[model samples]
Target: MGIAGVLEDARPAAAMVVVEFIFSALQIFIKLALDDGMDVRVLVAYRLMFGAAFLCPVAFLIERKKRPPLTVKVVTGLFLCGLFGITINQNLIVLAIKLTNSTTIVTALSNLTPQSTFIVAILSRMETLKLKKPSGRAKLTGTLVGLGGAMLLTFYKGPEMKFLRNLGHTGLSHAQGSHQQLRPPPAEGSRILGSFLAITSCFSYAIWLTIQAKVGQVYPCHYSIAAMVCLFGAVQSTLLALCLHRDTDHWRLGLNIRLYSSAYAGIVASGSAFPLMSWCLRKKGPLYVAMFGPLIIVFVAVMSSIVLDENLHIGIVLGAVLIVAGLYMVLWGKAREEDEQEADEPKAKAVGQDEELGKETTAVNGES
Candidate 1:
């Protein structure tokens, strides 16, 4: 490949890394905003609504030519993607953050994405196992390591709870009013359970990505698909939020920093990120994008410690290292496999041509 080709190929990976990093940082900001008494359901609903409002026009303008016809199958796929990917995933994630520490949730959830994606891909017939292939073996090993790291992050509390006792004034004050007798201080066991729920949300998201890959193959328009999904998610989330909140005043919009934070998450994180992710996945494939999940975890851990006044524990650092190492091993094996396949293409073509020529010669001989 020429220098230009190399640069072109590098851009998508770079873009994905940047996007994921931004998303990681954005989580800290979201947590801060949520700390200001924003309801999780309300936050999720507004994010979906605002994201859809922002993305629809862009999709229509950019993907006007390649937009798929509005069929029942396409609509149903979009709705399902919206429900699981945006509505349930976002709500559960915000709930996890509210219920547990950001460091634990981020680390545990980050490692689960690849394992979930792998399992769903295999079950959906998107990927196969070939134990003889190095790529296959490496992928399987990497996935197991990733899963083990997730289990450790979610289940093991280590010898000490570094951040458990350090609940700041804000968290303490918030804890006092809501179920004071029933809810106690943040416990290691509860944090572990919250981490598990976050991981489950990651698995749900992985299913969404695998399904989106198939949808991309069929529809071929990333922006349009994203727009439709966001639209459906907004509708579903709004209804759910309404059902959860009885007082109409609780749903009213407020003009404050929280509102601005919601807009930022909606426009940049949900609206822009979702479509960008889909485009990257379509062009580069799922493994390429999924490989950056651990990178996001690291960024989130650092930013959360700094911005949210959370502690950086030794366990988090070790878990992050294991997760990133495992992710890169998987991605590296995949790259090598792709390179080998490319190199073998010409040999396979030549062999097929020779076999066809031999058959033609034999036929001529028999006829003569």
Candidate 2:
């Protein structure tokens, strides 16, 4: 391949890493911004609306020339993607964040997407089963390891109140009351359930990505498709938020830092990221970009610790390492497969040329 081809391949990987970092930080920001005074449902509604509003003009300006004709088929696909990807995914994710820390939520959930993508793609006939290949085995094993890590993160809570040992040395005794008020009481069972819900949300997102891959092949206009999906999501999410939060006080918008956080999530995380993700999927394939989801967990861990002043527990570190290791295993397997395929190409080409020459010679002999 030429230098340009190498750079082109690297671009999507680099873009996805940036997207992962932004997405991870967005979760931590959202968690910090959430308060008992605000309704989670209302926040979801605002995010969708603001995200759509941010993307609408850009889509119109850039995709105007290449826009696919609006048809029922395209509209239906966009609506479904919007419903699953935006509405359900964001709702469950925010609810999970409300129940748990962003580190746990992002870590467990992000790890599930690749496996879910594989499963949904296989079921939808978008991906093939290759049980015979080492790469296939590695992907399967990596997925299982990731799930195990998630389970360990969710189910196992280390010894409770252990921090009391260092209370005197750290001068935590004086700040006990304030710390208690600042930290939400931990609910192990509830948080485990929330983690499960987050995993389910990841599955829904994976299915959306797999379906969108096929849709993009047919439409080839990422901006238009993503804009329409966001618009539909904004409408649906707004109605749902209104229904869930009937009190007018909850609907009131205020000029605050939380609003700024919402704007960042809407404009940068959703609006810009969504279309870029679609374009990357079209150019690099689903597996290529989907592999970066696990990195979000690391970003969330680092940012949440810094911003929220959360402790970097041993379990969190171990879980993060396991998730990264599993993700690398899956990506390594994919790379090996690509390498093997590249090695076979020349032989396949030669075989095809030989068959074609033989066919032409046989045809001439028949004519003679």
Candidate 3:
């Protein structure tokens, strides 16, 4: 392949890496916000609202001419998407971090996203698994390895990984202090609860990724669907928050980490990241997008140790190692699958597909 062809192939991968990095940073911010006593419900409500505000206008202007009609199926799918992706998924994530008193733990569990997605896809007949094929075996092995790592991460808390904690605390904790807990350590029950919540969140996220693919298949307007997701999530979560809290005190926006983190979550993380991920999902499929989950753990591990005074225990370090190993195995399998699929296709059709892919950047700016 030529330089342009290579760049085209690399673009989405690079975007996902950047998005995951942003996610790692956002985990730190949200942990800080939650530490400062921001309620998870309130945080989720405001985040979706902020995301809706940022994406609605952009989606409208960009997809104005070619936007598809909002069919009932698409609308219903979007509502569920918002619920799974934003409301339940995000709240569970924030609460998991708070309850566990450790961002790294929650992050480590996210490695299960791709594994869950793969299993769900197979059950739903969206994908097929052939044990005879090397690629299929690699994919299965990767999922099994990742699941084992997640189990280890959950059940075992070995020695603290002091090396990670000593990495970049000076910068992450400049506003606070060196190597300090964001709050008092939680009870054992809360940690277990948090681990369960984190696992649920990953499954919810996997379901969202699957639904998003289906939604995109029906309604190709990326930004519009993303905006709808945020808007619906905002409305749903806000109502839920109101039902629980009744008082408006928690809804008040203040000029603090809560507001900053919420805005960043909504605008940058959800608003910006969603459309990019949707594009990648359309291009490389859900498993490709989900594979990036393992990368987030490493980033969160370092950042959590520095910013949230989270200790990377032996379980975490070893689990992360296995997870990363599994990630690459899955990625390699996917790559081989794609290469074989292309080889099976007519050369002219492959060239045509590449041409369309070459238009990816322009399409991102134009369609989405």
Candidate 4:
């Protein structure tokens, strides 16, 4: 209606677009870094460490006044959040991307988060459903469609689409320290392992989302929660890196793309994106926020093709289309439900007001 109103409405859309693009770039950067022989665990460890370093100060500066006492319950939730959200989620995704060499596949499958979150909510009794209702049916249908799309992306590798052939391999490739050269794909075993990892990461992310919702309710300070999670994740990942990548060589960082990629992933992807998503979840609910998940797929698909020399297959194109469609369907259903609820509120309030007026009239007539 007004400038303020329009800007307010556009904020979430803008945030989604910005975050997704940052993530797309992060994926490409991380892949390039890994291709340069950066250890996965070390990369993730640095990412969380830098993320915490950035987030902790901001949380203290901004949410310091609003920060509540950390109870055992909140601390425990943050620990689990870090474990699932950062440790498992990041590890699986990195492995997936390494093996598959397709950020498109990774992100496309991530669109399953809404469906997984919905199921997790139901199981945890956080959400109730009436399958007989239009809203319920719509949600179920959307979930199925989204899952189907994910499956297609995971298993089916159709021929590359001809329309996009003209784009060429514009991305700088890394092969044995050679920059701007085309790199070959990994073995079939690696691909299979990466696909499995990606699928598992999706479910892990859904569980993280569910737990994040619960934690957000008890502790409304989004920045603080994100900071704490990053801290815990940093600790966990560092330990794992120490144990698994025991080489002192693995810990060393050079003035190379590895440093740049880790910095971007930490500052932009984790530091900024997590807090924004948490706030959005608090304001708009998880489904509303999750609907924007498809943007990452689109961004990654284009960026991966250009930056990583990743190809787009027919299955990927088809799966992305289905996932986007399902995203809109679920969002539409949620909007309809909200509209119906809002409509009923006015009618209920009017009835109460009319009843009160009638009672006042009766009292006046008796007094007269």
Candidate 5:
């Protein structure tokens, strides 16, 4: 490939790394805000609102010509996407952070996306199950292994790594390193409840991915679709927050950590991350996009330990390794299948050309 071609591919990969780093930082920020007593619902509402506002004008400016008229079906799909992708996922994530810690949440999220999405695709018939093929078997096994790893991470909290035991905070906190519990009163039940919520959120996110594929096929405008999803997500989350949080105290956002967290989550994670990921998805296939998720786990593990004072547990490390291993197995299998298909294309074309030549010769013989 030419230098220009190499640069073109390099850009998206670089962008994805930056996106993961931003997202990793966002997790810590969200934890900080919650630790500062920001209600999860209220936090979600503000994040969605800010994200929607950020994206609306950009979508209007760039995709106005390409944007299609909104049909009821498209609108409904967008609504569902918001409900599952933004509202449920983010809410559960915050709650999980409240219950457990950011490192655990990131570990659960490490390599589950592809496995969950693949399972959903098979059930929905969006992806075929070719059991005879090695790719199909590898995907199946990998999905199981990934799920098992997540389960291990949730159920098993081994002793902290000895080397990382005495590490100090990375000074990401603003309040003189005071780490207070900002979550609900239930502390003992956190591990069990948090694990369930985290796993459920993964499933909900997978469903959103399946629906997004269908929506993309119909609308085909990435920015416009993202804007609509954010708009609807803001409305849904706000309503939910109002119903649950009647106390205006929880919604108060002064010039504190709460305000900063909401701003970063909105502008950086939601608003900026979505469009950037969408562009990467378009440029590099879903597998390429999925390959970058493990990077979040690495970033989160190191950052969480330093910033949030979270322990680096042996179980988390072991489970993360298994999850990533299974992820690569599935990706390698799919890549091999794609390569085989590409290799056969030339032979198929050659056969077609030969048939055409024989027909032409027969026609000439008849003419003679």
Candidate 6:
């Protein structure tokens, strides 16, 4: 490969790193909007709608000529992907952050997404346990460790991280006197509930990841599919938002954090981020993309510490270690499995070639 080829190969890796930063910023933005007292439902609705508006035109221009027809089955699948993937996933995420009052929790839990996806793949018969193989064993161990980390994060917060807490209070001085102070941070029960919501949100995303393959198979137009999902999710989220909150004032976005966060979430996070991810997925495969998962957690932890002045706990420290360790183990196993398969291919081909040559010689001898 020449310079161009090398650059092209490196592009996805760089893009994924940027994507993780975008995602980390997204959580902070959403949390900021929530702190500003914008209703979560309203924010989600606006976000999906904004994403749709940004993406629909691009999809139409790029894929309109070559895109597949939107048949009933395809539309239905897209709708469900929107419902479970975008609508449910986005809403639950916002709610979880609101309850936890910490972006770190959400980002930490997100590491579970890959594990959930792996489990879903195995149960759906797309993959084997391969428990007998070292690669498989690594993957299994990784999943268990990751789950243990999540459980630890949820159940035990450990001692208060006083230094970090002090940093948060200092960082948040300007953000004080908002509705945030009026409503006390979540108690134990609320924290547990928030953790549950975050876990459920991760599963919802995993389900989307798995089913998107079927949608992609039929549509084959990634841009168009994303546009449709955003459009559908917008509609679903708006209806739900209206049902939950009747105040028109809450829907209005002034020159404030609420508007800024919504715009960023919709335009940058949903609109731009999705396409970049699609590009990376096509270029580098899911494993390569997944290997970057740990980056999001790191980004979020740092951002939260600096931006939200959020404190870290012993549980968070310990849980992050386990989850990140698990993610690498799983990715490593997958890499090895792929490498072994690739190595076997040439050997198998050589064996077949030798058999063919021997058969040709035998035929010639018989003729003589």
Candidate 2 off by > 4 Å: 1-18, 159-183, 273-294, 344-368
Model 6 Cα displacement at 216 (Å)?
A: 1.2
In order of TM-score, best first, we have 6, 5, 4, 3, 1, 2
Off by over 4 Å in 4: 1-12, 162-165, 171-183, 275-288, 339-368
Report the Cα lDDT for candidate 1.
0.74
RMSD of 4: 4.4
Query: Per-residue alpha-carbon lDDT of model 3 for 102-164, expressed as tens digits?
Result: 888888887777777778889889999978877889889988897788777777788876986
Among these predictions, the greatest lDDT belongs to 6
lDDT by residue (36-115, candidate 5, tens digit) is 77898999999988889899898899998888898999999999999999899888878887787554455555357778
Candidates 1 and 3 compared: the better one by lDDT is 3
Error of 2 at 80 (Å): 1.0
- In candidate 5, stretches whose alpha carbon ends up further than 4 angstroms from where it belongs are 1-9, 173-176, 180-188, 340-368
Model 1 agreement with the true structure over 179-285: per-residue lDDT tens digits: 43344446777677777678778878988887776687778787888888989989999899999886866667778757776787789887767766777877888
lDDT of 3: 0.83
Instruction: State the displacement of the C-alpha of residue 80, model 4, in Å, after optimal TM-score superposition.
Output: 0.7
Q: Rate the local accuracy (lDDT) of all candidates.
A: 0.74, 0.73, 0.83, 0.81, 0.81, 0.87
Better model by lDDT, 2 or 5?
5
- Best candidate according to TM-score: 6
- For all predicted structures, in order, the TM-scores are 0.82, 0.82, 0.83, 0.85, 0.87, 0.88
The sequence of per-residue lDDT tens digits that candidate 4 reaches over residues 281-304 is: 667776667677777877777776
Predict model 5's lDDT versus the native: 0.81
What are the per-residue Cα lDDT tens digits for candidate 2 across 1-368?
Answer: 99999998788888888888888778765775664346777788888788889888888999898886877777788898999898898888888877765454555456767666666777888767677988788877777777777776676656432342233323322334354357675587767777887888888898787667667777877777777788888898899998878887877776874686678888998887776787787788866876777777766655554455454555655665666667767776678778878988999999999999999999999999
